[model samples]
Target: SDLPLLCQHFINNYNQENGTTVKGISNETLQLLTTYHWPGNVRELNIAIERACIDARKGIITVDNLLRFTQNVSRQNISSENYRGFDIKEARKEAEKAVIIRALKASNNNRRKAAELMEISRSALYNKIIELEID
Candidate 1:
């Protein structure tokens, strides 16, 4: 769709501006960007793609390059969930669990790396992994 083409254009333009060799975006990367709900709209997408291109360094942009932006979008979606009768403590726990899961996934299930990403101690992450019953 237009999203992919837009991303491609942005990548091309960014390369030209930076004097870097133009690199292509993988279909997977385009799919990831297209599927995301851009809370900040085109401007945000433009910035994210620009950052992704810089991070990619003339290599194909991959989903990894878009992780931070996608994570922000996902967090916004989670925050919009209806908690109904849930107390503040319960909501906090839910949010914590979600963040822990994301950290784990982002770190490829490496507990140490996940803890570092969360800025928590390794033991704390292990404790949460047990407390949250995260699979």
Candidate 2:
């Protein structure tokens, strides 16, 4: 609703202002944002957005950037040292996959409801599950 409109606005201005043509993070970022149950609420989103914008030197926000925020939102600070013992990238992906599945289940598999529960858009959630290679 209001949130999609808001992100859309960000997408438009961000491209114009940065001249980098990177699509706004909404496609993937919104799914990450909306599916979290938003216990911490919009303040959390603001902080995440600020961070993404700060990191966007090229204008594009990759899935990697969103993944960083995802990890942050989950507070999974498994520490770089411990992750060295295992395939850290795979481990993180697995953990993130679990989080999305749990969120979907909590919302009864209704992607829209799940997105709302996560504070994201229905379409964004669908796109992300595919993008993340989540079954």
Candidate 3:
């Protein structure tokens, strides 16, 4: 409801500020954005939209534009078999894996620091790494 309007406002503001002529986002792309959980909230949404606008280059922001918004998460084509029939458990696993990988990378591969960043015990983090089969 209001999400689309919010996104539109963001896009309009960005276009005005940057002197770009991005018309609007496609319906499909808008649906995707509105439906996303947006774990990082409004700030993350703002950054994602801004980045997408830059990548769009005066064109209507497409799904491709949003797909590149986050490196940690996989927001690729939903029509792909990989995303088809997705369940909560699988989605949770994917999210956990992404977070763990991000934490590890941020901590320079130091498991203890990564665990601290995640607010989990070192052994718990180690167990998750093994369970998720993260190299």
lDDT score at residue 36, model 1, on the 0-100 scale: 62
Q: How well does candidate 3 match the true structure in TM-score terms?
A: 0.54
Per-structure clash totals for the candidates: 0, 5, 0
Instruction: Please give, for residues 49-74, the per-residue lDDT of candidate 2 as tens digits.
Output: 54466455466554445444454654
Q: Which parts of model 2 are misplaced by more than 4 Å?
A: 8-23, 69-135
Model 1 worst lDDT window (10 residues): 74-83
Candidate 1, residue 32: the lDDT equals 48
Against the true structure, whose TM-score is highest? 3
Tens digits of lDDT, candidate 1, 1-135: 689788888888898899976577777667545646787888887887887777674587765555533446433332213343335456445656777787889899999999887667999988878987888
lDDT of each: 0.68, 0.56, 0.71
Error of 3 at 23 (Å): 0.8
How does each model score on TM-score?
0.53, 0.40, 0.54
Residue 122 of model 2: what lDDT? 78
Alpha-carbon lDDT of model 3: 0.71
lDDT of 3 by residue, 44-122 (tens): 8788788889878458887656654543223332311123345645654665676678789989999999888666799
